[model samples]
Target: MTKVKIASTTDVSSDKVLKTSANGKSVLVAKVGDNYCAIANKCPHFGLPLAKGKFENGVITCPFHGSKFEICTGKNVEWVDSFVGIPLPAIAQKMIAMGKSPTDVANFAVTQEGTDLFIDS
Candidate 1:
């Protein structure tokens, strides 16, 4: 397993997101209590960095297209109850479900350990 020591537990506060990049892909680090949770850094919609997006109730919205996703899994928040791989007529819907209108996910690998993060292939 690959591990990157990002920061200490004190560096982040509960409910706040600390974003960084590893392996050229966006990495989002969030502090919940004394532990850190890491996930993909970019929004599933429009490929916007999740760091630039807003977080609320464990969910985040893409700034580029108003698409929302769950911060932990990078999956669509499902406001309209749509599937990730499905395409809708609404542009905003597509963004939320697929991260971009033309949803072709560039797969990457990432993980976290003891407040540190790692990006592996």
Candidate 2:
């Protein structure tokens, strides 16, 4: 595994996310309590950056399609359930999903050395 330097501990706070790249792959790093997590920055629904989405309680919701994913484990919590910021019906959600199955986002192992943060890529 290659350890790629991402940011300093001070660069990311509990309420903020640090957007960076590791080995040519875009990633978003967040500090949860005293631990740190790194996940793919792109949302699988529309291939858009997830940094603009909402992150809460270890889950990140895709802004475009409202797909919720577990930030730490890269698990899919919910598929497309909304359009933009408006809630959609189940039938509408399925239609908008375009037959795409729910997929988890990619996650990287994060390690902190002193005040520097690193991710394995």
Candidate 3:
């Protein structure tokens, strides 16, 4: 478990992204109040760079498809049995191996100390 310094407290503003490295993997950090939170920079749903998106009420909305995801939870904004409810414009995709879901493949984490954020790859 490696911890990398991604940004200085003065660098990222609340609701912004700061890229970091922990265990040789790219991670995304976001400002929440006076503290910072980190998560995988790649979107679990579409593998997009979440750093280019916006954060609102602890959730980050993907710019590519406007899909909302919980930064702290790393889960889709809404769901019911492997289905997405949001109508945001999205790219067509090959379905997940039937019955399976995106949540099955996502394993993002968020941690912080003061204004510094950390992630585990």
Candidate 4:
């Protein structure tokens, strides 16, 4: 695997996420406590950019469909439960999901060197 420098330590905080590219692949970098985490920047639900989503407590909520994912592990916490930040009914959510099952985003290994952070892509 090749290590690609994605961001600097100052570029991300615990409450914020940085959207960058790793070897031409969209990557989301977040600082969780003292550790750094990196995941695919695209939402698995609709291929939407996760950079515009909300990040809190090591989880990211997709803005378009409200799919929640764990940034560190890229695990799907909730899937397609809302639209444009508004909660949707179960029936409506199912319809909006369009038979697509919940999927986890891709995660990459992050290595920190001084103020710079690199991801194994």
Candidate 5:
């Protein structure tokens, strides 16, 4: 695995996310308590930058489509709900999806050395 240095632990607070790149892939690094997590910065649903999304608890909600994902695991918690904060009906969601389905975002392994943070890409 290629260990790419993303940022220093001090650079990312528990409430903030640090955006970086590794192996030509945009990555988002965030700290949860004493552990650190690395995941794709782009939302899988619409390829929107997740840095502009909301991060709460352990989930990040896409700003464009409202798709929710688990930060540490990159698991798809919820599919597209609406654009921005507008609520979408079930019919609208189905129409928007057509035949597509929500997929999990890519997650990278994170490691810390001293105060520096590295992501395995």
Candidate 6:
């Protein structure tokens, strides 16, 4: 594994995500409280960039399809609910996945060195 320095600690504020690329892979670094988490910047559902997604309480909601993921663990929290308040049938939800199943986003291990942040990609 290669450790790439992506940003300074100050560059990522609490509850905010900083988008950067490491080793040719797009990464999103977020600071939740006192801990820092790093994950792939793309949504697993449709390969959409997650930089525009909403982050709250370590959960990121994809802007395109409303897929929610846990930032720290890269676990799938919710799938294909981007239809806002509208409730869709299970079959419709499955169709929105484009025949793909829900998958976790790729997460990178993050380490802090002084003021710099390094991620293993």
Q: In model 6, what are the clashing residue pairs, if there are any?
A: none
Estimate, for each residue in 1-121, the C-alpha lDDT of model 4 and write its tens digit.
Answer: 8988999998988998998998899999998988999999899988999998999999999999999999999999999999999999999999999999999999988998999999887
> If ranked by TM-score, best first, what sequence of candidates would result?
4, 2, 5, 6, 3, 1
Error of 5 at 10 (Å): 0.5
TM-score of each: 0.59, 0.94, 0.62, 0.96, 0.93, 0.90
* TM-score between model 3 and native: 0.62
lDDT of 3 by residue, 1-121 (tens): 6555666666666756777666766666666664566677776665767677667777776665455666655667632222242342222322322332444114355555676545555
- For model 6, the superposed segments whose C-alpha errors exceed 4 Å read 84-89
Q: Of the pair 2 and 6, which is ahead by lDDT?
A: 2
Kindly list the per-residue Cα lDDT of model 5 for residues 32-54, writing each as its tens digit.
Answer: 87789989998877687998788
Per model, state how many residue pairs clash.
4, 0, 0, 0, 0, 0
Shift in Å, residue 120, candidate 1? 5.3
Worst 10 residues of 2 by lDDT: 9-18
Candidate 6 lDDT over 1-121, as tens digits, reads 8889999988998777889999898999998778888999998887888888888998888887889888888999998975543656887888887888889999987899999999877
Best by lDDT: 4
lDDT of 2 by residue, 7-103 (tens): 8988887776778998899999888877898899988877888888888887888889999888788899999998887999999999989999999
Error of 1 at 44 (Å): 3.0
lDDT of 2 at 43: 85
The TM-score of predicted model 1 comes to: 0.59
Give the Å error, residue 108, model 6.
Answer: 0.6
lDDT of candidate 1 at residue 17, scale 0 to 100: 76
Per-residue lDDT of 75-111 in model 1, one digit per residue for the tens?
Answer: 6654323334343556546444544343322323334
